[model samples]
Structures are given as C-alpha cells and as structure tokens.
Target: MSSPTSVLLAGGGSAGHVSPLLALADTLTRRHPDLVVTALGTEEGLEARLIPARGFGLRFVPKVPLPRRPSADLLKLPGRLKAAVDAAGAAIDETGAEVVVGFGGYVSTPAYLAARRRRVPIVIHEQNARPGLANRVGARFTTFVATTFSTTDLPHARRIGMPLRREIATLDRSALRDEALAHFGLATEWPTVLVTGGSLGAKRLNDAFASTVAALSRGGVQVLHVTGQGKTFVPDVPAVGAPYVVVEYADRMELAYAAADLVVARSGANTVCELTTVGLPAVYVPLPIGNGEQRLNAADVVAAGGGLLVDDDALTPHWVETELIPLATDGDRLAVMARASAALGEPAADEQLADLVELAWGTRA
Candidate 1:
C-alpha cells in the first residue's frame, strides 16, 4: 500500500512517446526524491539520449515493429517479441519495480507482456485521439489507462490531457514576448508567426512557407521558421518589411512559442497540446502519411475554433497568401482563438497523472 520505491516506464522511438514519459518522470521524482524512475526503451529510441539527459536511468530492449501488412518482418516478429519481452522482464527485475507505466509505442508491447507476466500493475497513457496499436493491446488488461483526448477510444480510458515539460507548462508568453523576439533576432514591433515541422522537418511545410517569405515580410509579419535539422535553407528574399528568420532547430521551443502571434505546423499530439497549452492560434497541417491520426488529433481544437486544420495537399503557397496571411493579420479573430485555445488547455495533466499513478500503485499496495 506504500508508494512505489521504483517505477519502470515504457515507450519510445518518437517524441510522441518520449516527451510524456520525461514529463511524468520529472513529476514523480520531483514529488518523491526516494522514488527511482527508470525507462525501458530501445537503443534506437530518442530516449537513449533524452532519458539520461533528464537524470533518469534507462534500460534497453530490442525494437520490435509490428508490421501493418504481412511481410518478412511479420514472420520474424514472434521471435523478436519474445526476446524483447525477456529483456523488458529483466529490466523490471533489475530495478525491483513496484509498478510499470507505459506510453504506447513499439517498446510498449514487450513491456506490457513482461509486466503482466511478473504481476506488476500496469498504467497506460495514450496521447492520440486515434489509439495506436501498442496502446490498444495494453488497454485490454490494464485498468489504469489515461488518454490525452477524451475521444481516444480505449477501454478503461480517463482523459488526463497531454503532459507537458516544465518549461512549456510554466511559460508566460506575453511576459516573455520581448525576450523571445530578441532571442530570435526579430523586431518586437511586427506581428510574428512560428512555422515548424518537428525535428526532421516536413517538405510540404518547408516548400509552402519558403515560397511565401517575401509576401509575409511585405505584410509586416515576422516569421520564425524551425526547418528541422539539416533542412535549413536561406530565404532568397531577405528581411525587408520584417525579419524572415529560419533555423535548423529550435533548442528552446518556449522562446519560439513566446514570440509567436500565430503557428503553422503539423498536428501531432505534442504540437496540438503545446499550442493549446500556451493559448496560441494555429493553422494545423496534418501529415499526409500514417493512420490519419493527425487529423483526429486536431479535431477538437478546430471544432472549438482555437485552430484551423488544412489538408496536407491543400496547404500551398496560394493558400498561405489567401487564407493564413489574412488570419495572421486579423487581431480581433486571433484574440478570440487565443481565448478558446486557453480554455481547452489542461495545464495540470502532469499533476493529475501523478495522482492516477498513485492510485494504480495502491492497487498493488
């Protein structure tokens, strides 16, 4: 019945899974210094670097990708799954874990299997409106399932919103606006828009915005474009009416959020949550690939009038000029959208999740 002395977290391979794992780890350790938080991930996962950087221990398992359709990989999956589950079981044993919490991903299936085999209580957090396969499987047996979107279809689901890092969670955009503008080397006077396509960048967003730099500058709109690592390109037309800034990555995303009057980006779970968390109006461009979950991620915000969703094929240079530019310049409409965005933000998800983990641990107690 006592609090868990040590906990094992499972999920990785992408920011979608790793970000929330890091957030929850931080919350747990902050609340209980004696609680040990170790992550179970693969060597290829972003967690390899991120988890250790956050001062948490990490264990590795083989990455087992569940093939969507029949293939050679699918045939080999049974063996790979057993190996990963064995590794996950060893990780739990080595840590003497009292409970296991999982954010669904490739690594999650093994963790779920291992934890179940060990009789370790399981907690699940699904970050998408469209549940991923890993989470769907874990949800069947875990009574402690939490979700970001209320519409997320998972058994035993409870809506806890997306967990955000401390920096983004505590950011005061208006208060930090001046410093953010200076940090990004943009004029404080111009209306600003932030365009991003995650760490690897998006060709669609890159192409569409690159073509419209001059048009945006002429309209006195400053642009902060995070073009992802290695996708950086010099704008052919330099800053004239306002600064047209571009960078390979935004190491300090809080500053980017602080400086923006508007955002144009993909509608991944993280992006959607961050925009709503800070009350920033956005033009969400769902990625063309995947299970069409990106479109589902932004549905509530778009319906709430906090953001706009544009099909990937339709977000072009012409559309930016005709639609986005006008919306960027509309101060009255931006204020309304900002209010709606703030209304939908759940700043306390991290704390709320900590409470649920407490409840789940009690089941073992």
Candidate 2:
C-alpha cells in the first residue's frame, strides 16, 4: 500500500474541529502537491466558509445532530444519517478518495461510515478532553485515532497534540512584540492582557472586561480586548495610564498573541493549544455549559502551572481587579508560566498527525 492520492477530510460546526481540519489539510497538501483533498461539512457549519476560503474543495452533507434525549429528531435521525452518508460516499466516489480523515463533528459520522463502506482507511482526530459522539462512533472502525489532550478518553487514542494554524504554532512572541504593539497601538512600557471571548463573544467576559478597563489601566496594565463580531463593549471611564484597545474582532490573532503577556479568555481546545504552543500565559475562563469539556481542556496546562483556570461564574470584574491585575503586572510569575506552557505544547503536531494519515494509508490492503 502507498499513501493516499486523494482523501476526504470531515468535521465542522465549530472552530475546534475546523481549525485542525484546515491545518492538517494544509500540511498534507503541502507535503503532496498533487494530492487531492476535499472537505466534507454542512453549509451551516463554519467549515462551509473556512474550507473553501482555504482553497480546498468542499462537499456538503446534511448536518445530523444526535439527540441527547427522546425527541422527534431522534425518529428522523436514521433517515438524515443515511442521506448524509450517501452524500459523503458520493463525495468520496467523485474525488476518488482513498482514505478519510475526520476531526469529529456533525459531518464526521457519515464520513467514517462512508469510508468504512468503501473499504477506505479512516483516521480520527479527537480535539477535546472529552470525546464527542461523532468521534466516539468513528473510533470503532479506525485503528488510527489521534487526540489533542492526553486525558481524552477514546479508543486507540494517540496524543499527537493539536494541529494548530501555522501562524499560531510558529508565533515568536518576543520577536513580534514591536509589531504587535504597533498594530494594536499599545505602549511598550506596560504589560498587556489580551481578552477574548471566542468568535461570538461571551457576555460574561465582555461585561467583566468592560467594567474593569479603568481598573486595569490604573494598575499600569495595557489591555487588548477582542469583543467578538457584533459584540460591543463600552468602557465606563478613560484609561488612567496604560492603553485600552477594544476591537470588534481581530483579523490577525497572531499579532494579538504577540502583544499580550497574559490572555484572559475561554479555555477552548484550540485556544489552549495555541497559547501553549506560542508560550503565552493565560487566565482560562471555561464556558459554563456543555459537557464541561472546556474546563477539562485547560487542566493539563493549568496543572503544569502554565495558566489559571477558573469557572465561568467565578470570572468576574472583581476577580480581574483582585487576581488578574496582580498576575499581569508580575513579570517574574508570567515568565515562569510562559515557560511551563511552552514545555507542554507540541509544536510539531501538524506534522505528527500527517504522519498518522500516511501510516494509515500505507497499511491499507
């Protein structure tokens, strides 16, 4: 057997899945210029735009959400899954896909099934500390399974770490410090905290940071707050000494990462990986909902003394004044955390994952 000439990469609905999918796609294509890579996702997913924008062909599959409880959607699941699998199989057939790589989301289940039916090799990548249902199902048919977090419970799990964007994985914070400061219009004198609430912005984070902008400035700390798209945050008072830069969104996150000494944001799998990979300290405020995966995602780093992990509700304006202010201003502490974060990060994860894909294809009969 030889490496796959063509492969179908499936996953979507969120950045956690799409980011890795895109990163792996880029690596595989770069390694094999003649390789044919097509993405499978629903139009509703972020992948619909991201995949195509990245210059990969995308095939649509019906988004199938597995019900948590007995519902009318449960009754319709079989038909939806069948249709999605059929669509996925057709994509495989059309592209002459010899293997399938799935990142575990709404589109992964069908990609796994279709590849199994076609006798094509399947490689699964589980992103979170807790595996999602799609990856759990996909794992059954594949011996090649990769995970971002070591604590992730999945069959045949191999922790290759997260496949991160090239910009994030290769970011040299010190080297880009000046560029970052100039881009965000921050002073070089003050220690900066980067505050983000993911793409959509968490109201809790927005409000907390909004209320404490003056407090942070008074502590001689600069702040770069990305308030998410369409999410606005108006500061109550002007800065006392340091700059308070607020933007709706950051197109160049690498610059933002470069500018900040500490990050105050959600502990998303991608965020954890990127921050660690780039060797930046953070204050992780995990989203309060879902299966508690966000909190789990930051466990290893927090345990390693890389960052502070706090509950969503626990992350308040008061905490910013009491805890975050001191931490950001303490240069010695932030340096120690940055070293710990870098130690835990796997910068070569994209290459390692690409190896697994090749290994899986090579073993195919």
Candidate 3:
C-alpha cells in the first residue's frame, strides 16, 4: 500500500478561521482514509480545543500578533515572529507535511513562511470579502487561493464558497421544520424570525430587537432571539402577548436555521454563507466598525434579492415595524428571496476546497 499523503492545515483564534479549517479537514480525511491531516494553531486560539475534539492532530505555535501602530509590543514583534516561524517549521518537519493549507490567522503567517522555506506547496482560503492581514501576507507564498465571495481580491483566487459542516450543508429545512420548531418550542402557525449577533452578541442588535418585540408580536410574528453568551441587556418588552424566546446562546444552530423563515443578524462571513446556503432570507445589520467588511459580506446576497441590509444606526423599532413586518408577512416574497439565496449558495465548498489542496499536493510531488 502507498504511504499516506501528509497535509498540514493552519488557522486559528476565531471561528471564522477555525470552522473552515475543520470542514476542509473533515472532507480531506473522508476522501482519502489514509490521509494524515494535522493542524497548526496558537495555544490561546479556539483551535486548541476544537481541533483535537474533532479527532485531528494539532500543534501550537507562539502567538505573534501584528501591531498596527508603534508600541512596545511592536519592538518585540520581529523576535516573536521569528520564534513562531521556527516553531511552525518544526511542526512541518515533524508532520512531514507535503502541502500546507492556510485559513487566515496568526498561525497562518508563520505556517506560510515555514512552508515556503521548506519548499512545500501552500494553499490559502479567505472567508471575508476583504482579505485579512494574515491572508494578504500568506498570499505572496502561493498562487492557489480560494474565497467565499467572488469579490475577494487575492492572487489567483477562486470563489469556492465557505466550507460548511455536513449538518448545515445537507440540511433540509422543510423536512425538519416541525422538529426544529419543537426543539425551540415555537409555534408552526406563526412566522418565526431568528435574530442573532454571533457568539459575543451585538449590543445594537439586542437593543433594537428588544425594543421592537412587542410590535413584531402584535403583527402575529414569533421570535427566536439568541442574545449571545454573557450579554445582559434584557428587553423590557412583555412576552405575555408575544411569542418571544430568548436564549443566551444556541449550541445547535441547525435547529435554529431550520425553524427560522427569516433571520435578523450581523453580516459576518460565516453567518452570511450559512444563511444563504440554507435559503433563509435575512435582515442584515452590518456591524458599524472595522474595515466595513460586514457590509461587503452582505452586499451580494442583498443585491441578488435574497435579503435586506440595514445600517446599524438605522436599525430601530420603527424600521422593524414598518419594513420587516411587511416583508415577513408576505409569504410569496419570502419564497422568492429564499430561491435567490439558494441559487447563490455553493454547498460543495468543502469538497471543492479539498480538491484545491489535493491539486497543491500533487504539484509539490
């Protein structure tokens, strides 16, 4: 029998980077049973826990955060980065990695540099519309780049969509609608809207939705609000008349997506990809900070007639009452939006990314 093809995947810190890495790793292993897949991350990153729990080998490198401004940390950056690169080089050698796949994060930078030094092929995947700093640096190491959005400008980038878990990629909302409603204790009769602001929760989303719960309930709409973990701003609105359910966090997002006819949330890359993939229309309130990447994330879906984009500052109770209520109540319009969303979704992204990695591996051999 031929020896196993060894591969190293790098990314970490946030779920944005880690989730896709896991998805691709899952795909690679399933396709080639003998594939030896290992991941590189920082000790402080979510990958430390998530990677091992998924049954993959993981190695950690020192976190070398790039400083945006001159500071004491910036002075230490050169040495820190060199140390990280050396650690990653040791990992590459130990794993006998022939190719390295990178999802942008602190780990990716060192992984890319080490791979280049070792003459190992590098493949990059960028999840956001605007490339992050790590991916930008990593891109120079190789021409193989995959992106979730077509508009993402990276060297030799192909729009491969976001790598999603099996549960989400194959979810049939209609088939599981009843079970989903039961899971959330929601009524099948009322149109349900799922509101979320990711795991950390958006204070603006929470406040705006809280103020408008009564109005939404009055309009015969039900709500499933995920307030994120540790967020404490409870809405003053009475739930006696409204069918409103608020949870601190949702562990089974598949159920929430299955139950929801509409979603009200921020336009993070993963959230937008999952929503569109499931054919769920949304009211995207882009986070009002950063490089305005959130707005760019939602732009294509909204333009394709799959959803609506409301400015963070413009999202108010009155906006929900006037705009969202009518849209949610119109079943015909919702169906149209759902169709548009499904058309834009690339459900085979995991497989496609695995193909890219395989291609890179072949090139190196």
Candidate 4:
C-alpha cells in the first residue's frame, strides 16, 4: 500500500473555485513531490490555462453550464456528459489517478461522474456557504466533503475554512501600513481602504466607491480600488486632490490587503475567508443573487462583530460616510474586528484537504 501518486482535480469558471484547487495542488505537490496532478475541465475555463501553466496536465472535456432558460445548452447535456466521461476516462487511464477531487463548478460535474463510473474514490471541497449547484449534486457521491462554512446541507461535509495562499496566511501586518502604502504608491498617513469585487471585481461595489471617491479623499482617506479590467466606475465627484490608486487590477492582492486599514468587498467565500485569515476589518456587501449565498458567507462574521454587511441596494455615499469611514479610523475598533476576524482563520485548511485527498485516494501510506 503506497500513497496515491496521482490525483484528478476538477474546477474552473471563477477564480473563487479555482484558487482553492490551486492552493491544494501547491500543498499536495510540496507534500509529495512525485504526485501527478491532472485537471479535467473545459478548455474555456481558467483551469484550462492555469492548470497547464502550473505544470499539471489537463484533460479538456466537452461541458457547458445549464442555462437559466431551457436553451440549446440544456438540450445538449446528455451528449456533453458522454463526451466529458469519455475525456475524463481517458485522462484517468493515462495518469492512473487514484482519486478525483471536485472543487465545485460546472467543470466538476463530469469528473465526478467519470470517477463514480470508474469506481474511484471522490472527495469534494465546497467553498461556498451555500453549495453551488454542481457541488450540491456532487456531494451525494463524495466520500468526504470539506467546506469553509460550518452550516451546509451536505451530510458528510466538514467545516474547514477556505484554503488561502501561504503568503496571505502569513501576511505581516506590522509592516502593513507602510508596506501596503508603498506597494500601491499611496500616502501612509491616510486611512487606506481596499475595495475589490472578489476575484472578478464587483461593479456595484465599484460604482458606490466611485461615487464617494472624492468625498473619501477630502475626508483624509486614501483608496486602493481594484476595478476589474474592462469595467467602468463613474465618480460622482471628481478626484480633486492627489489621485487615489485607481487600478483595473492589482496582481499582488496580498499587498492590497496588507496596505488597507479596512476593506469593502463582495462576501464571496474566498474573500471572506482571506479577510478572516489576514485579520482585516471589512464592510462586506454580498452579491444579492443566487439564493443569497454571499450574504450567508458574511453573516457569521457580521453577527460575531468581525465585519459589517451592506446590501447592494443600501450601498450609498451616505452609508459609506456614516458607517465605513468611522470604522476605518477607529484604531481600537479596527483592532477588535481584526482580532475577531483572525479568530476565524483555519490555516491548516490545505493540509486538511490533503488528508481528505489521501483518504479518497485510498492510500494507507
């Protein structure tokens, strides 16, 4: 009985789903250098590019999302499933993958099915407070299910906080003020706000921020706004003073997190988890869609006094000025929220996921 030398990880579409898989893959490779990690996903997915770029082989499958309306995509589901299984079957045969790990997305469906058909063990890492459609369905077949949220419907799902990159988990807040300011080339003296819409960026969040950008700067705050590439935010009041760092994207999010006294972002599981891991006080505006999963993700922290939740509809300059601005400058309150947020961190998430992966692989060694 040797340790499983190979694994098939399935994920894609959004960075939220793919990032956890990337973290797990990095950890697994470190723990077992000989491990062969293969990804099964559509060529259009972020994984299609990222997996191969990370030196893992990927088997592209023919799978598309089920449309909200009964479209041609839904009509083609049977054929797509067949093609996915065929592709995954070939990849598994080629790589001798002992387990298929599902990270929860459309791409994960076929891999889960393929693994079930091949009688390989299955493990699932569900990153949302509310399980996505794919993970909810995939959970029935999973021998082990890990989740960031304590509350989920999956019978076997265990509470394990989201896995973050090592850098984020070990971020140095002692240099946070100076380092983050320097990283973004902003003033160290002003209260800095880090605004993001999750990995994809949030247009609503950006719009709200833009409306108050000048007012915020006039009130002695510095802004580090990550507007997703190709998105627009119309500033209701023009930036009159030295411009805030208005970038489309920041490649170094760790730096962004490090620099900010407070964060205003979507309450995606990954965003919330990272905020908890790094111990940043935040104003979370959960995306008000899809059964309100994002709201659930931020609710625990908000209830615990670790963060604040704002509905997109309620997001306005008045609210930002009244609530968020004061919180940013209150050092004692920030520390309290930071400590409370840090209390939610699960740094061993990657290792825990690896343990599950090993169990799924059926390797005693």
Candidate 5:
C-alpha cells in the first residue's frame, strides 16, 4: 500500500485561527483515515490544548510576536524569529510533511519561512476580510491562498469561506428550535434575540445590551444573553415581567443560534462566519479598537443585506430601543435578512479547503 500523505498545519494564538485549522484538520483526517496530520503552534497559544484534545499530533514553537513599533523588543526580533524558524524546520523534517497549510498567527510566519527553506509546498488560509501581518508575510512564499471573504486582499487569494465544525456546518435550526428554546428556558413562541460578546466578553456589548434589556422585553422579544465568563452588567430599569435569560457562557452555540431570531454581537471573523452560516440576522457592533478588521469582517454581510453594522460608539441603549427593537419585531425584515445570510454562507468550506491543500500537495510532487 502507498504510504499516507503527510501534512503539517500551522496556526494559533486565538480561537479564530485555531478553530479553522482544527476544522480543516478534522476534514482531512475524516476523508482519508490514513492521512498523517500534524499541527505546529506556540506553547502560549490556545492550540497547545485544543489541538491535542482533538486527537492530532502537535509540536510547539516559540511565539515571536512582530513588534509594531521601534522598541527594545524589536531589536531582539531577528534572533527570536530565527530560533522559531529553526524549531519549525526541525518539526517539518521530523514529520516528512509534503505540504504545510497555514492559518495566520505567530506560528504561521515561522512555519511559512521554514517550509519555503525546505522546499515544501505551502498553502495559506486567511480568516478575515483584511489579512493579518503573518499571512501578508507568508503570502510571498506561496501562490496557493484561500480566504473566508472574497474581499480579503492577499496574493492569489481564493474565496473558500471559513472552515466550520461539523455541528455548525450541518445544523438545522428549524429542526432543533423547540429543543433549543427548552435548553435556554425561553418561550417557545416568543421572538428571541441572542446577545454574545465572544468567550471573554465585550464590556461595551455587555453594557449596551444590559441597559436595553427592559426595552427589548417590553417589545415582546425574549433574550438569551451569553455574557462572557465572570462579566456582568445590570440594567438600571426596573424589572418587567419579560423573559431575559442570562448565562456566563454557552457550551452549545448551536442551540443558541437555533433559538434566536436576531443576534447582537461583536463581528469577529469566526462569529460573522458562524452567524451567516446558520442564517441568523445580526446587529454587529465592531470592537472599537484593533486594525479595523472587525468592521471589515462584517461589511460584506451587512452590504449583502444579511445583517446590520453598528459602530461601537453608536450602539447605545437608545439605539437598541429605537432601532433594534423595531427590527427584531419586524418579521418580514428578519426573514429577508436570514435568506441573505444563508446565501452568503459556504457550508462546504472544510471540504473546499482540504481540496486546496491536496492541490498544493500535488503541485509539489
């Protein structure tokens, strides 16, 4: 029998990068059970825990963060990065990997350089509408690039969508709606709005949504709010007899997506992809900081009539009461937005990305 094709996947730091890498890894292994898949990440990155837990072999490399400004750290960057590249090259040699797929993070930069030095074919996947610094550097070494958004500016970028977990990619909201409502203890017939600020929570999202809970409840909209772990903000308004469910975290996001008619959240690339994939209309409040990638992530969905993008400063209690309440109550508008969102979703991204990796591998051989 022919030996299994060996592949090394590199990405880490945040769940945004790690999740898609896992999704792709899962896809490749499922399709070809004999495939040898390995992951490279930094000790500090979330991948250290997540990758192994998913039953894949993982190797660690040093995290060499790019210094944005001229400073003391910048002076030592060359040596630091060189050490990382050497470590990554060693992993490549040991695995005998034919192709290296990168999902942009601290690990990816070194992985790309090391793979280039070893003459291994490289494939890159960018999760955001705007490419990160690591992907930008890595793009120069490889012609094979895939992106979640069509507008992402990267070398030879092809729109392959975000690789989502099996649970999310195949979720049927209608079939699970009743079970989802029960899971959250929400009213079965009431229109619901789900609010989330990711796992660590967004203070701005928390404060705005908390202040407007009463108003939303008064509009006959039930709420399932997932406040990030240990984060809380109470509304000043006196409690009305409205359904307002609050939780520290949601372990089953599929149920959360199923139970909601409207969603209010940050527009991280992963969140945007999942929401659109599930056909959920959302009011995206981009984080006011960062390189404006959050805003860019939500732009296409908003432009495509799938959702609304509200600036962080503009998402006040008053705005929620006037704008959000009206939109949530309008069934006709919500249906239209849901359809638009589904139209933009690529549920087959995992398969598509695996195909891209194979194409790159073939080119190398």
Candidate 6:
C-alpha cells in the first residue's frame, strides 16, 4: 500500500505567522482526515506551544533572524542556516513528507530550501501586502506562490487572500451583538470600540488606549480591550457613562468583531485581513519599527479608503479625542468605510490556497 500523504509546514516568530498556519492546518485536516501535517519551527518560538496545542506534531530547528546590517550574528548565519536545513531535512524525512508548504518566517527559509534540495515541490503563502524576506527567498523555490494581495511581485504569484478561519469568513454582527456584548458584560446601547494589540499586544497601543479610555467612556463609548498577557492598565475608577471591559487576551476574535463598532489596533497582516473580512471601520496604528512593513500594510487599507492610519509618533490622546471620536460618531461615514472594507474581503481564500497546496503536493505524489 502507498504510504499516507504527509506535508511539512514551516512558520514561526509571531502569532500572526503561526495563526494562519494553524488555520490552514485546520482546513487541510478537515478536508483530508488522513493526511499527516507536521509543523517545523524553533523551540523558542510562539509556535512551539501553539502548533502542538492544535494537535499537530512540531519539529524544532534552531534559527536566528538575519538582520539587515552586518553584525556578529550575521557571521553566524551561514552556520545557523546549515543547522536549520539539516533539522528541516530530518523533520521531512521523519514525516515522509511528499511536499513542503512555507508560511513565510525564519523557520520557513531553511525548511523550504531543504525541500527544494531533495526535489520536493514547495508552496509558499505571502500573507502581507509587502512580502517578507523569507517569503521573497522561498518564492524562487516555490512551485506556486499564494498571496493576500493581487499586487505581489513574486514571480507567478496568484491572488488568494489570507486564509482566514471559518468563524472570521462567515461572521455576521447583526444578530450576535447582544450576545457578544453580554459576554463582555457590556451594554448594547452605546457605541463600542474594540482595542486589540495583536496576540502579544503592543505597548504603545496599550499606553495610548489606557490614557484615552476614560475620555471615550465619558463620550458614551464602551470598550473591549485585549491587552495581551503581561501588561496591565487601570482605567478611571468613576463609572463614566459607559463600561470598559479589559481582557489580558481574547481567544474569541469573532465575538470581539461582532461587539465592536470600530477597531483601534496595530495593522499586522492578520489584523488587516480580519478587519477587512469583517467589514470593520478602523483606526490603524502600525507598529512603528523596522522595514515599515506594518505601515505599508496599513497604507493599503487607508489608500483603499477602508481605514485611517496613524503614525506612532503622532498618536496622542488629543488626536484620538479629535479624530477617532468624530469618526466614531458619524455612523454614515463609518458605513462608507465599512463598505470599502467589505469590498476588500476575500472569504474564499482558504479554499483557493487549499487547491494550490493540493496541486503542488499532487505533482510530487
């Protein structure tokens, strides 16, 4: 009998990278129950806990991210890359993988390259508006390239939006607002703002929101703040008209979307896609750091008229008081932005990516 088909998937670093991989894994398993999927990542990454929690086996590889400028770690990159390649090869061998799918991170670079060396077909998913270094390198070896944006410059890249979870794809806030509000112990009478700082949270976002939450509350804005794991922020003690529900982290994102009138968060690719897919008008503050890729992602949404992007340096409570308060008040304007966001939604992207992955693996099989 032919051995059961297996796939080696690689992704790491942030939950943004890991969540999509898990989403795809969930989709693949639901479609083909017998197909084996193993995640290749670093032991230290967020994936180490997340991947296994989803019931998939994880194979670890040591990897250090390559910085743009030359440094001591740069000198060790060659050795680290070699080690990661060997680890990826072993994982592929152990899983009897017919092909590899890389989800664009440091972990993916060596794993996909190892698959290429072994003549195994590879597929890559570029989730960002601008491709990351790993996906850019992996694209050359990829049998097919899948991207969230149609404008990706990767050779032979196809327009398949980010693979979102079923809940996100089919979410409708109309009927569930009451239930979502009740879950957060909030009243449904007031305007709501959902503030999330990604899975790990953003300090800048937390600080800004903490400072402004009271003012928003006084303006009759109810808040659901996902503050990440370790951070704590105390809102004003006086019951200022509206409720402020704060959570360290939330697993039920769909519910959060349903309960929100507007979103105030960082513009990570996952957040961008979720906001677009759910048709949520948002004030996006991209993490102001290296490469400015997050800003680029936010620019696409702002340029598309779906949301507004704020520079981190300029994100003050006064600005929020002026801009976001007014924007939130104008329901008509919010609806216009919502329509623009809905226009960008791609609900069928998961199936499209599945088809691409199957085709890539089928040829090798």
Alpha-carbon local distance difference test for all models? 0.92, 0.92, 0.91, 0.82, 0.91, 0.84
Order of quality (TM-score): 2, 1, 5, 3, 6, 4
Q: What is the lDDT of residue 323 in candidate 3?
A: 88
Model 2: per-residue Cα lDDT over 1-365, one tens digit each: 34568988998999999999999999999999889999999999899889999899999999888898999999999999999999999999999988899999899999999999989999999999999898999999989999999999988999999998898888888999999999989999999999999889889889888888889888888899999999876655453588888899999999999999999989999999999999998999999998899999999999999999888888889999999999999999999999999998988999999999998888777
Error of 4 at 326 (Å): 1.6
TM-score of 2: 0.97
lDDT minimum window of 10 residues, candidate 2:
232-241
Per-residue lDDT over 1-365 for candidate 1, one digit per residue giving the tens place of the 0 to 100 score: 45779999999999999999999999999999899999999999899999999899999999888887999989899999999999999999999998899999888999999999888889999999999888999998788999999799999899989999989988899999999999999898888999999999999999999999998888777899999989999986653588899999999999999999999999999999999999999999999898999999999999999999999999999998889888888999999999998888988889888888888888883
Name the candidate, 1 or 4, with the larger TM-score value. Answer: 1
lDDT of 5 by residue, 17-88 (tens): 999999999999998898889999988889989999999999999999888899999999999999999999
lDDT of 3 by residue, 1-365 (tens): 33338999999999999999999999998988888899999899899999999999999999998889999999999999999999999999998998899999899999999999999999999999999988998898888899999999888899999999988999999999999999988888889999999889998888878888778888888899999898745545555544788888889999999999999999999999999889999999999989999999998999999999999989888888998889888999999999998888988999999988878877874
Evaluate residue 361 in candidate 4 and report its C-alpha lDDT on the 0 to 100 scale.
74
Candidate 4 off by > 4 Å: 67-75, 232-243, 363-365
Error of 5 at 118 (Å): 1.0
TM-score of each: 0.97, 0.97, 0.96, 0.92, 0.96, 0.94
lDDT (10s digit) by residue, model 6, range 1-365: 33337988899887778878888888888888998999999888999998998899999998758878988888888998899899999999899998788988889999878998898889899888789888899888765999887666787899888888899988998778888999888897888889888767888778877888778787777788899898867777345478888898887889999998899998888888889988998999888887777877777678889899888877788887777777777889888998898888888788887788888876773
Per-residue lDDT for 97 in model 5? 93
Total residue pair clashes for candidate 3: 0
**RMSD of each candidate?**
1.3, 1.3, 1.7, 2.5, 1.7, 2.1
- Regions of candidate 5 where Cα sits further than 4 Å from its true position: 1-4, 233-241
Q: Which has the better lDDT: candidate 2, or candidate 5?
A: 2
Clashing pairs in 2: none
TM-score result, candidate 5: 0.96
Off by over 4 Å in 6: 1-4, 237-240
User: Which regions of candidate 1 fall more than 4 Å away from where they truly are?
Assistant: none
